[model samples]
Target: MANTTALLFFSLAAFAACSPSTCTFIPSTNATTTNYPGSSFIKTSAYPYNISVLSEVPIATICTSPTGNRTAELACARIYIDAIDEQLAFLYARRLGYAAVAGASKFATNTSLNDPSRNDVVAAGMAAKVLKYGATEAAGAVMGGEGCMIYAALKYEVETIQEECNNKFTVDVERVCK
Candidate 1:
């Protein structure tokens, strides 16, 4: 009886040690000041990475200008898009690390590989939330019809990041783990 109890305790301890680690995605925050007055509409800091994106024209001006200036509109889009790209890249790397841990745990225990779709779902969801929040913030800063351009650009950027998330976590995780 004592030997069986000892074996049971050991199994529980080993299982606890082998549990998978959790992955978290924290969204970036907007900074209050822009170095150039008219250059950027929104400035955000990608924490831990020390990266930031700044718009070229004040978002209000871009929205209110009678003639839709493609140059200014693209410039504003570029900053937020760039920020989204950087943030996604950071999150991807972190997700890869988590996948590696899970993979290693499976291998150590001689367990069948678990489906990676779960991780992909989580990564994609987080990426969508981050990009959407950034876009919403940018659109909120402009009044009336002016926000259309920003929204359009943001939509494209979001699609691009979502694709990237699918490729990175879904496809890449399998390759890395195998």
Candidate 2:
């Protein structure tokens, strides 16, 4: 009975350790209500602030050449630039009160892409077409493929932000873009 109890406890502990929990990317909006003696109604508002979290950008390094240093240097430079662009986008999203999603969707969407299915469907279709039809096209094909991702992200940002705004709120994309 003692051995069985110990085993059960250990199993439970292990299970708890491995359990997945929901993590909030955005901070909670709950705020304490303030009331004035003169006012009959109470004020309900969250803190006058926005919270944002960004992912760590990886650094580029020169590694010993497996296929000439030129290839490695170009590859490293490309990854470094990509990381810089990703960080810039993260900052922009955070400034606009958007939470970054994990995986390819993060890069592929303008604003969490609204529909999760859209991310997968679009990515799969684009990747397949690139592989099948654009295999010989090389540079042009790559640019076209990347263009699709930008289009998806732009669409998401426009739709999601518009949907999130209050009826009275007015958004000036031009101002924001500036």
Candidate 3:
């Protein structure tokens, strides 16, 4: 329960940290996305993640308590991971497009990953491993005292997704984004 709660909190924080440039797609204009005046647009912090199969993920309830539903709970977490991954991928795609039209670091907070020694980056790596092996085991991936790890996974996944989207988009990210 505590772990899932932490994961939710950190995930929200991570999303807020990285979701500015790609919050909403402006129709018919690649050159203009949303220029959030001041800091960043935190649209996703409260927006629904749009998980398909399950309606609402009661992370505290079905995640780890009442060992009888372990299988379902684990499945629930894995599904959440996938959904979160998809959202991250989508955010990456849009951010790439926004960066192309806008500058590389216009709306992004700490866009540079130069400082590999950063604690968040290291913990995100740990989160990555948790995500990697969590595919099957899934205990630490979704349950237990791994909220920060899960949040890191989401955080680091943004970088990876951004690179992938850059390679895949960039050329027409501006035009095609419309």
Candidate 4:
């Protein structure tokens, strides 16, 4: 009876520890609530970006890896940066495409992009560091082809800010591009 109880306890503990459903990425409280002058753009665009990235980069795979903690940290940073990129896209669209005077005024006044203390900026810095680590790791080992290539490209895109999260919040390119 004692041995059976111990076995059950260990089994339950292992299940709790390994459950993928328990793992989730939550944004920083400040990032979630930040209300910049033109924050509506960010609020609208962030969800799809989060969903797209989350789908492309399987949380279970990253969360279960030996370096799971680092990978999960990078994932969170990627989500936050994607949100911020939405704001930047809105600013650019408003300025160059729509010629909105209000957007220009907001862009001139909004200092969040340059402020190192802002949640988005802090998250970007963290993402950059982790991506460098991931790229190094990728280069050192065999990544098993397409999945590994996708991860590498994601790190590159995050590092370069080449793929901005626009109004579309599309990750189609990230999914298919090699």
Q: What is the C-alpha lDDT of each candidate?
A: 0.40, 0.40, 0.42, 0.38
For model 1, residues 1-178, the per-residue Cα lDDT tens digits are 9999999999977654434332222222222234322225545453222343333213334333357788776776666556556554554444444444444444445443344354344434544554564655323333111323223323332333233222222212222211
Best candidate (score: lDDT) = 3
Candidate order, lDDT descending: 3, 1, 2, 4
Q: Score every model by TM-score.
A: 0.34, 0.23, 0.28, 0.21
User: Once superposed on the true structure, which residue ranges of model 3 sit more than 4 Å away at CA?
Assistant: 1-61, 102-178
Q: Could you tell me how far off, in angstroms, the CA of residue 115 lies in candidate 4 after the best superposition? A: 29
Error of 1 at 139 (Å): 20
The alpha-carbon deviation from the true structure for residue 44 of candidate 2, after best TM-score superposition, in angstroms, is 38
How well is each residue in 1-178 modelled by candidate 2, as lDDT tens digits?
9999999999987654433231223322222122221123543232111111232333343334666778777776765565455445544444333332331233233233334345445445655666674354343333333344434445544444334321222223221100
Off by over 4 Å in 1: 1-66, 116-178
Q: Candidate 2 clashing pairs?
A: 109-153, 110-153
Worst 10 residues of 2 by lDDT: 169-178
RMSD for each of the candidates: 14.3, 20.5, 20.2, 24.4
Candidate 1 residue 10 C-alpha distance from true site, Å? 30
lDDT of 1: 0.40
Q: Residue 101 of model 4: what lDDT? A: 27
